[model samples]
Target: MLERNEALKVIHERHSTRMFLETPVADEDVRAILDAANQAPSAHNQQSWRFIVLKGKYKEELADLVLSKAADFPKPSSTLLRLASRSIHSAPVIIAVANTGELIARGGDLFNIKDGSGVDFFRIMEIQSSAAAVQNLLLAATSLGLGTVWLGVLVLIKDDILKFIGEPKGEFMAVIPLGYPGQSSRGPKKKSLEAVIKYFVDE
Candidate 1:
């Protein structure tokens, strides 16, 4: 178990770095982060999460895809686009995580006959489980002196990205860009704990 101070340090220091240095992240460190993600819990151990690691020209292509899609929708800030561009250009790695919808299922031994059930339930579970795993991956990166940013904008161009990454249709939840921080960043602003939390008691 991590000591309280060590855990808190990781949490407090973790930030969504938009600018990254030119240095490339070592392959071993990338493997370590992914391994940490694999350690995340899954529903019925289905482990439905899949990932595509993007770099070089592929990353630039993805950024263009995002920018084009964003233009088609409501006008977002120029600053946001610049930040996204900087992130993609400067970061050494980007991980695209997808959910394999069809893979969730029940299993049984050859000798025993058991009806398969809870596949749908397991799909939902995969989302929650994969999210937790992503969180772990982010924390692990921060602990190792790296930076990360979660981008939900990819969902808008999910189909394009899936095709770009060669992921099968209907499989992916989110994409996260990771690297060393070029510009120090404070995490996003958040509501106070009192405003966001509620407690319930059973009678």
Candidate 2:
């Protein structure tokens, strides 16, 4: 039997890191993470993921914006927004992802259907591709011993956040805040493979 490989080890080590230390992440490590993300598969090779790395004063400014605008939202939403803002402030690096609005059919032809009637389907593919990239980024960060959390709450106020960062793109997918972890994390429970998986073989 083969031993557990480095890839599987990193995948198991990956978890949501909400708290972080004050130390800044190295630029080379950040580059490696982004490179991993860019290598993710996309539908028809659209490669629709766009990433914006935030640090220093820009990072602080974004946290402040999220906090200020969060009050305008409803109760639970406001609470979630505040949490996202706090995460941004705690991390040394934040990478924001957007869809870029470019899909399979726009730049070229689809599978013989050229009327743009199924634009919604193409949009979903773009979002899925971006999500795959984010997963790659998380795994890469874990391999480098960096802590990261995928901040989905950041998408709640996507427009203001995007405008603040001067990114004129499709839609905000997610933001990842990463740094050296300040505290340890216990892995969350997951369903067993046998419980979640099923075979669909023909008789």
Candidate 3:
């Protein structure tokens, strides 16, 4: 278990890193992050997350595709694009998280649920499970002294991304670009916890 101060430091220092250095994330580090992700709790112990690591030429292609799609949409300021461009060029790796939508049976019993019902339940579980895994991955990266950013801008162009990654239909959830942060990425301002959280209790 991590000490409280260590945990707090990771949480506080973790920010979306856009600009990155050209250093590649080591295979062992990637495995460690994935292992941490696997440790995330899932409903009924259904762990249904798939990840594709893109590096080298593949990463460059993904960045190009993303920028092409961005050009077609309403966008943030040109400054943002310039920053994203630099980030893509500098980062050495990108990871695409995907979902298989496979139903995980409780125990060895697979015939307990109705046919379609199992799939429906699994779909919902996959989304929740994968999200938790992603959080774990990000936190793990921070713990390893690496930086990561969750890019939602390109998520809207899901179909294009899926095609670019050669993912068959119904296999992916989202793509996350991972790497070392360059000196330029200023983390975005976050809302205060008081403004975003609410508590109610009865004694």
Could you report the Cα RMSD, in angstroms, for every candidate shown? 4.1, 2.0, 3.9
Our model 1 lands, by Cα RMSD against the true structure, at 4.1
What TM-score would you give candidate 3 relative to the actual structure?
0.80
Put down candidate 3 lDDT per residue, 1-203, tens digits, no spaces.
24479878787778888777778889999889889988988766767677788888888887777666666655473334445545666778777777655544442245466555566566677788888988888888989988887665555667777777776664566666677777754477888889999989787
- Candidate 1 C-alpha lDDT tens digits along 83-116: 5655776788998888876445442322132555
Question: Candidate 2 versus the native: TM-score?
Answer: 0.93
TM-score of every prediction relative to native: 0.82, 0.93, 0.80
Per TM-score, the best of the predicted structures is 2
Tens digits of per-residue lDDT for model 2, 1-203 = 23399998788888898889999899999999999999999988989888899998999999999999899999899998898889999999999998887785473365555777667788888989999999999999999999998888877888987787677666888888999987998569788888999999999
Q: How accurate is candidate 2 locally (lDDT)?
A: 0.88
lDDT of each: 0.76, 0.88, 0.72
TM-score head-to-head 1 vs 3, winner: 1
Q: Residue pairs in steric clash, candidate 3?
A: 19-182
